[model samples]
Structure formats: C-alpha cells, structure tokens
Target chain A: MISIIIMNKTAADIFDEYLAAKGLRQTNQRRQILDAFISVKSHCTIADLYDVLKKKDPSIGFATVHRNLRLLCEAGLAQEIKIGSGKARFELTFGQSHHDHLICLKCGKFIEVFDMQIERLQEKLAEANDFLPRKHKLEIYGYCRQCR
Target chain B: MISIIIMNKTAADIFDEYLAAKGLRQTNQRRQILDAFISVKSHCTIADLYDVLKKKDPSIGFATVHRNLRLLCEAGLAQEIKIGSGKARFELTFGQSHHDHLICLKCGKFIEVFDMQIERLQEKLAEANDFLPRKHKLEIYGYCRQCR
Candidate 1:
C-alpha cells in the first residue's frame, strides 16, 4: 500500500510547473481560491466556494469561483466529483495515491480510502477490453458511521 | 477474480422483483423499453431512447420514455451515468462486476472496464472514512482504443 504524505515542497514546485505548462497566471484570485480550498478541506460546491471567497474578500463573484475551478480542474490541480446530487463538488487532486469517496448522504461528509486489490482488478478489466486506462473517479454514497 | 458470464434468467427474475418492489406496473411499454435498452448496446441519452422507441413503436410518447427511464432507475434496473454532461446516459445494472468508462470526446463512445484495483481502493477509502458503501460510478473521459 502507498503511504499518504503531506503536500511537501517538491509537490508545490511541481504544481508550479504544472501551472506554467497550462499557461495559467499565478494571480491573486487563484492563490486566494487555492488557499480557501486547502483551508476548507471538504467536498465543496461552486456556491460553497463562492461563499468562502466572499468571506475572505467581498469582491469575488460566483463566476470567478466557477472559472477558477474549471482552470484548476483543467490544470490537473483539482478533481470534480458528481455524487448524484444537484451540484458537482471539487477537491484537490492527490497524485499516485488514488482513492474513492464514501460520501455521507445527510451531513455530506467525504471519506477517502485506498485499496490495492480493487486497483489490480480495474487494470485487468481494462486490458480485457483493449482499453487504455487514464484517470477515473469512484464515489460511493451512503450514510457515514456516525450517522448510522 | 469474478468472471463475466451470460446474464441469465436469474437476472431477469431479479429485475422483475425490483419492478414489483417499486410498485411499477409491468406493462408492455415497460417490456418494450427494457428490450430496447438491452438491444441498443450503447450508452444512451433519453433522446436516444425516445428515437429508438419511435422507430419501433411510434405510439410511445417522449414523456413515456422519460417516465419509464425514471422508473427503471428507481427500480435499480438501469444505471445512470453523468459525465459532466447536461443530460445522462443509462445502461443495465449488473452485479458487483465493477467497471469504468473510457468516453470518446467526439463520438461519445462509452467503453466499460471492470477494474478490481480501483474497486478495492474505493472500498478501502470508504472503510478508512467509516462510510458504508452503497453505490459507485467511475467515468474516465478519453478517446477509445479505435479513436485513439
């Protein structure tokens, strides 16, 4: 199993390189959005992000939040999850250590887990179909332990 | 590894039970819809379903297809996939044979793969977060083998 690690300096440097490759400007809004995202560690809707940005700086609009999110998603800085709900949620992308979500139906809690057995099965299935695997998102919806 | 096998009478029996559980009347329209769904052999939007139904039986209204699709989803007879697209496509739901999609950007071809590694990782993710796994969908957007 791959051990989970903190976002170290090397990761940050690589993130900068990713930004440059995407031709994205390292602007104040982008930094603020990323800060708010990291600080608020949970699945967040576009409106939720907008609300958080509003709390920090009153001038940020919903469009900005949506646009920055698309940028972040395009730059491989974040992942978007649609949990059969009304709106989609965005979270930062964690490379290598791939996991899926256990989403709380009521309180909207997200639990991330990593299992190697499932991963091997996925590869085998892909190969059987002659598919070239790329990125994938697996989200499981249910009540959390506390909720249950 | 769980081997893929023919979907036999047991599958249809289960689907029938699901229909009963959902209090849906097993009408000719329902049977025709199921047959049409199974015969299409591709991920389809409601519009696509309607078109197919129209070709076979012109009497079926668009609203009927929509309503039946909703019922099919409620009865767990079908799976709905939302790939950041405005509308949703659906396919018949099989058992725990996990799969992901390789979607074509141009032609909208959805190739399914059962990746055990991803499934296991998803389970571990849910376990780590104390989340009970209920349902999951993994869609990886990219060109298919032929498209690539």
Candidate 2:
C-alpha cells in the first residue's frame, strides 16, 4: 500500500497557473475553498468543504463552492469522485499522484491507495482494445474493519 | 478487447428468484423494464431506459423504471455505472461479467471491456491493504476512434 503524501506544489500554485493561462480571476472565496480542500486529509463533498469554509467566510454559498471545484478539475488540481451513494466527491490530485479508493459502505468512509501493478495492467488493457485512455477510476466498496 | 456476449439466463429468471425470496410481487411493469434492459446493447441511464419503455407502455413512469432498476441491482441482474458525468447509468451483470468501461468524453459513449490481468492486479492490491473486497468500478475516459 502506498502512503498518502502531500504534493510539493500545492493546489494554489496549480490553480494560479491555470487561471493565468485562462485569464480567470482568483477570487477570495475561491482561495478559501482551495485552502480548505488542501487541508483536508481525505475526500470531501462540496458541502463538507463548505461547512469548514463558511465558518471563516459566511458569504460563501454552495453554488460558488461547486463552480470553483469544477474549475479546479479543469485546472488539474482536483478530481471528481463517486462511491455508489450517487453524490459526487472531490479529491486533490496531481498528474503523477493517481490512486484508487477503498470505500466503506456502512460508515461512508474512504481510503486512498496506490498500486503500480494495477496501473500497468490498465495500460495493457487499453492498448489491447486500441482505446487511448486518458483517465480512469477504481473504487472498491465494502464494510471496513471497524464496521465489520 | 472482449466481445459482448448475451447471458444464458434471462433477467426475468434472475429477478423472479430474487422477488420470490423477498416475498415481492413481480409486477407487469417490472417485467417490461427488464425486457427493455435485456434488449439494450449497452449501458443506459434510468432516463434512457425509461424513454424506450415509455414508447411501448405510455403508462410507465420514470419513478417506476428507477425503482425496478434498483430492484434489478439488488437481484444481481443489473449494475449501476458512471463515467465522471455525475448521472448514474446501469448495465446487466452476471456473476461472471467482471468488466470495466472505456468512456468517450467527446460523444458521451461508454464501451465495456474486460481483462483478467486487471482483475488479478486489483485482487492483489486489496489483499495488500487487508481489505475484504466486495465490488469495484473502473471507467477510463477519452475520445473514441470516430471522435479522435
């Protein structure tokens, strides 16, 4: 199992570059969302991040949080995630920090893990199918140890 | 690339056992939904299936289609799928299916394909983490040949 490590360049750096190239403004609330997202230790929904950010900036709304996250994905600083609950979650990601998820169905808990072997096997499958793969998601769901 | 093969047992057979074991009635509408799903050649969302079913039975409601699809999932006759587009989609799944998706972002198309090597690698990852695996989803997204 690969340990979760912080990226050397933060989401702010990535977003700034993205905004500069795209000619987008980096608003204060957007910055706050980025900070809360960066500080989170695991995957979180928009509401989860908003609860934390709203305490600092009550003016922030759910739609604003949602829009910024969409931008973050376009900027390659975050990725959308789903774990069978029909709600979308977001997680910080880098070009090289790709991983899969182990979700706890009973407790709504998620664990991030990485495996080089799985990555290689996916490349082989895509090649065999003649499909040029850009991105992939693998989520394993079951009762966690504590829940079991 | 694996060829899509029809399952030996029909959805009605699988769902009948499921409904009988649960002491649930197999309604006529439920039967129609199952038929449309069985006839479908690829993954479909509730709206997509509902549209097709409505053409045959104008009385069929979206909620009814959604509910029956949920039951189909409980009976192991169908599997819910998504490819980073937020909306939930579903496909048929026998115990032996064990495939993943290659989604086309440009045209919103999804292709199902399987690989034994990918499955074995996932098992290895789960074992390494002491996770008792239950279910998993892998969706790779990019342009299809036509789109490219």
Candidate 1, residues A5-119, lDDT tens digits: the string is 4565433454566789877667778777776776666578889988988987999878888988887777666777777747988887744356766678888777776556666
| Candidate 2 Cα deviation (angstroms), residue A107 | 2.2
TM-scores of the models, in the given order? 0.74, 0.86
Please tell me how candidate 2 rates in CAPRI terms: medium
Clashing pairs in 2: none
RMSD per model, one decimal:
5.9, 4.5
lDDT of 2 by residue, A23-100 (tens): 999889888878788776557888888898889889899999999988988987788876665668888775446788
User: Which regions of candidate 2 deviate over 4 angstroms?
Assistant: A1-10, A94-96, B1-10, B94-96
DockQ of each: 0.48, 0.63
Lowest summed-lDDT stretch of 10 residues in model 1 chain A?
A1-10
* TM-scores of chain A, one for each prediction: 0.80, 0.86
Worst 10 residues of 2 chain A by lDDT: A1-10
Name the runs in model 1 displaced over 4 angstroms.
A1-26, A94-97, B1-32, B56-59, B94-108, B114-130, B138-143
Q: lDDT of each model, Cα atoms only? A: 0.71, 0.79
